[model samples]
Target: MEQKVFAFLMFSGQADEAMKLYVSAFEDAGIVSAKYYPQSEPGAKPKVLHAIFSIKGQQVMCIDNQLSDSHPHAFTPALSLFVNCDSEAEINEVFAKLAEDGKVLMPLSPSPVSTLFGWLEDKYGVSWQLNLPAR
Candidate 1:
């Protein structure tokens, strides 16, 4: 059996906003399911304890503000999302849109392996590695 990749994100009380933004950005994005604390469970806070959303046909799970300020940071460069793109136009559109108000760690240009490639951190603080795979 082959192992699958699923992204689990922890936000500082912005999971709902992030999900809304990402869902609007991706064509087929949708919530598979979600549960709100306290409203659906007893004695819980009103934070997003667990939720799943699909992006571009891929599923990504997330949580929000579940930990205190003492919680250790878990995000890293090694865990960035890898977007497999099919065309330069599509890549440019996504890369540009995501780079708005965000830092572009790597500029979009031709590489030895890709004609369109770049690394960017979106305004929401999520990192994305965009690339147009060889046709």
Candidate 2:
């Protein structure tokens, strides 16, 4: 038997926003399901409890982490969502959208392995690698 695996992202009450951005940015993408936290106290803001969304058919799970400021863990560039673009135009468009208000680790340019390749961390601190594979 084979086990299914998917990327899970923890957000500081930004999971909903991130999911909306991702689904809008990628084609054939949408939220599959979402669960929100019930307001437990007066004037408490409801947060995303869990959400499963798909980007071009790849499913990713996200949740809001209501942790204290002293929490040591955070999203890092070490793990990234690698996108294999079908064309230069697609890569450029997606890259630009993702780079908005985000840090670009490597500018999109031709490389030995790909005609267009770049790395960036989005506003939500999620790293992504865009690449146009060799024809």
Candidate 3:
């Protein structure tokens, strides 16, 4: 079986805001193809139900809190996006931008596999791991 990796982000009732922030981040980073959820039906709760955005050439799936059954822990840092970058410069740029107004779990620096690496939770509280492969 050929499996693919998709990052499904969970937000605490801020999916739309997070999606907007992410789209801005990716666009500022020069990435393309950012999309968001459709408008809800009448009396329906609006949500970022599904989206496909690229981050440094990687496809990522994003969504808002629409389902009632999603557990709180299911949206924790353990399930953050792992961004693989091409250069330290790119890594630093992306990480610093995403870290604004958010918490930094690990500062950008050399890791065993990447020249620059960091872990950050975006302003929306969705965690992400930015890494630049050593070249």
Worst 10 residues of 3 by lDDT: 27-36
Please give the lDDT score for candidate 1. 0.77
Per-residue CA lDDT of model 1 for 48-98, tens digit only, reads 778988876788888886564778454556667888777787788878887
lDDT of 1 at 34: 79
Q: At residue 124, give the lDDT of candidate 3.
A: 76
lDDT of 2 by residue, 23-134 (tens): 8887778999999988788876557899999887788999888772557357899999998988888889889999999999999999999988999999989999999988
Worst 10 residues of 2 by lDDT: 66-75
Q: For this target, which candidate reaches the highest TM-score against the unseen true structure?
A: 2
Clash number for model 2? 0
Best-to-worst TM-score order: 2, 1, 3
**What digit string (tens of lDDT, one per residue) describes model 3 on residues 1-135?**
422876666664566566656666654433233344565577554566565666555666666655545555345787788878766666777788889999999998887887778999888777899877778
Model 1 off-target regions past 4 Å?
Answer: 1-4, 39-46, 72-74
**Residue-level error in angstroms, candidate 2, position 31:** 0.7
Q: After superposition, how far is residue 41 of candidate 2 from its true place, in Å?
A: 8.2
RMSD of each: 3.8, 2.3, 4.4
Each prediction's TM-score against the native? 0.79, 0.89, 0.69
